[model samples]
Target: MVNSKFEFTNIKCYCPVDKFCHVEYCYLKSVNRSYKYFSARSNIHQNPITNFTVNLALLKRYNGYKPFLYNFTVDGCKFLGNSKAANPVSKYFFEFFAPYMNANHKCPYDHDLIIEKLPASSMDYRLSKLLPFPEGDYLFNITWLIIGIPHGNIQIYGSLS
Candidate 1:
């Protein structure tokens, strides 16, 4: 078995439509060699999100960030209701952090979406065993769209070795 180590290097959040939604906080905290956490909070100030979509792009740092294995968009509501059928790749990635997020339910997200203190270890099996990836730096570029309009973006940067 290949012994792998995964760690989050940074997290960045941006809300283009600040009047309608905004990211309160997004950060990666490392307490020790074995303890690391990633957190992000986004507030929806407008009407409840009845419909939304997410564009996921996985990029690897070769000479620079280049498209890796996956790049697709999935309907957020559909994914929340039936993940496997919506998109297996997105489901796999979503499951990596779903346990720590409060936005797992179906459409109409009326409350603040929060992902707090998501331990990095939660992704060990998926990143190392289930879908083994080459040792390198990676970036997950995720864009949130409400009714086909861009609302926010979250970029998660990490490395596997």
Candidate 2:
């Protein structure tokens, strides 16, 4: 759920409903879902390669940092899931993939593979790469670990530095 305290621009998912489903649930169902393409809901004059910064936080309501995997497919990019924790160095792992993601499309594999420890750390070293413009727009899929608690925070940002 998005909080009212922050400002966010609402955008719709351009992909068909079947393709828009997050991959974590498929794992929960013990199924392998198909990966298809999607376009950004918002219009961009130029496809900006954003520096994606994903921040995973432990929900205050939970005992500790929760763990799981999330997955989704876009522009035929396939990101796999890895279990990890929330430590100082691990922030870069999330940043490595940040260049590929946006606010609407998150890693679908976040629910299945979760980190077991608090103050966890892991590194995903996806290099800075340009995403091909989709036939209509750009799309990419990501599979990453996330916490299990409902209240954990997620943040996305573009780096000017």
Candidate 3:
């Protein structure tokens, strides 16, 4: 649930009707839902290689962050879940994907991925590389992971390494 305190914009709904959006999000990729192609609801093709940063806490709430309509992809990215107790559900999701991510990755969350605020940021990509993540593969967007297989040439800027 989005807080009344912060006002967001351009919110689109891509969730299935059955599962509690989050859990459904997990099943959609593996279960092979209708979105075999890049669907708008999934926001798959909006890969801006965003120099803009992601709002991890907002992502935990609305599944994506939008202070305004702008680049919302996680190409060159950071993983806040590994260090702080922010999004527990999202943290669990990442943990499930850990083996494939990186061997040296450090998970931050102590509890079960609770939806809380961490000292998060937006557009802070310069120092992210030196922060230590997996070699070869960078912290690509969580949307990339959620969308599973890609059907077209998705230009992810951060994962260039």
TM-score versus the correct structure, for each prediction: 0.94, 0.18, 0.21
Ranking by lDDT: 1, 3, 2
> Which wins on lDDT, candidate 2 or candidate 3?
3
lDDT of 3 by residue, 85-126 (tens): 535444433343333323223332122112111111111222
Candidate 3: where are CA atoms >4 Å away? Answer: 1-82, 103-142, 145-161
Angstrom error of the Cα, residue 39, model 3: value is 23
Order of candidate numbers by TM-score, starting with the best = 1, 3, 2
Query: Which of the two candidates, 1 or 2, achieves a greater TM-score against the reference?
Result: 1
Report the alpha-carbon TM-score of model 3 versus the true structure: 0.21
Residue range 22-83, candidate 1, lDDT tens digits: 88899988899899999999888987788899999999999999999999998899889887
lDDT of 1 at 108: 83
Off by over 4 Å in 1: none
Predicted model with the maximum lDDT = 1
Which residue pairs does candidate 3 place in steric collision? 53-123, 74-141, 82-107, 82-108, 83-108, 87-113, 88-112, 88-113, 88-114
lDDT of 1: 0.87
Q: Which structure among the candidates has the greatest TM-score?
A: 1
